[model samples]
Target: MIAKELHDKTPDQLRDELVNLKKEAFNLRFQQATGQLENPARLRTVKRDVARVKTVLNQKAAAAATDA
Candidate 1:
C-alpha cells in the first residue's frame, strides 16, 4: 500500500488488509518449508510490502492524532 492509497482507505479496510497480508506470509512460509517456494525472493517482497502498508498506516494514524 502506497501512502496515497493508504490515506484514502478507511481504518476498517486497512485492518482487513493487514490480516490478509499476515495470512499470505504464513502461506509463503509453509511453501518454503515444503521446499516448494519457487521464488525465494517472494518472501522478501511480501515482507517489504507488509512493512510498507504498516508504515503508511502509522503515518495516517499520526496525522489523525494531530488533526484531533
Candidate 2:
C-alpha cells in the first residue's frame, strides 16, 4: 500500500492494518527459518510500510494536539 493511502485511512483502520502487517512479518520470518520464503525482500518492504503508517499516525496526532 502507498503512504498516501495509509495516511488517508481512519485511525481504527490504520491500527488494524498495522497489526496485520506485523503478523505477516512474523509469518514471513517463520517461513524464512523453514527455508520456505521465496522473496525475502518482501519483509523489508512491509517493515518500511509499517513505519510509514506509524509516521502518518503520529503526524495526525501532532496536528490534532496543536489544533486543540
Candidate 3:
C-alpha cells in the first residue's frame, strides 16, 4: 500500500490495517527463523508498510489534536 492511499482512510481503518500488517510481519519473521521464507524481500516490504501506516496514523492524530 502507498502513503497516499493510507492518507485517505479514517483512523479506525488505518488502525485495522496496522494490526493486519503487524500480524503478517510476525508470520514473515517466523518463516524466516524456520528458513522457510519464500521471498526475503517481502519482509522488508511489510516492515516499510508498517512504518507507512504508523506514520499516517500519527499524522492523523496530530491533526486531530490540533483541530481540537
Cα lDDT, model 2, residue 2: 87
lDDT measured at residue 65 in model 2 versus the true structure, 0 to 100 = 96
Instruction: Provide the lDDT at 34 for model 3.
Output: 98
Evaluation by TM-score, superior candidate among 1 and 3 = 3
Ranking by TM-score: 3, 2, 1
Model 2 scores worst on lDDT over the 10 consecutive residues at 3-12
Error of 1 at 24 (Å): 0.5
Q: What's the TM-score of every candidate structure?
A: 0.84, 0.92, 0.97
CA lDDT, candidate 1, residue 50: 82
TM-score of 2: 0.92
Question: In model 2, what is the error at residue 63, expressed in angstroms?
Answer: 0.9
* Regions of candidate 3 where Cα sits further than 4 Å from its true position: none
Give the Cα-based TM-score of candidate 3 against the true structure.
Answer: 0.97
Off by over 4 Å in 1: none
51: Cα error in model 2, Å:
0.6
lDDT per residue, candidate 3, 1-68, as tens digits? 87899999999999999999999999999999999999999999999999999999999999999999
What does candidate 1's lDDT look like per residue over 1-68, in tens digits?
A: 46677778887888788888889999999999999999999889878878877887788789899999
Q: What TM-score would you give candidate 1 relative to the actual structure?
A: 0.84
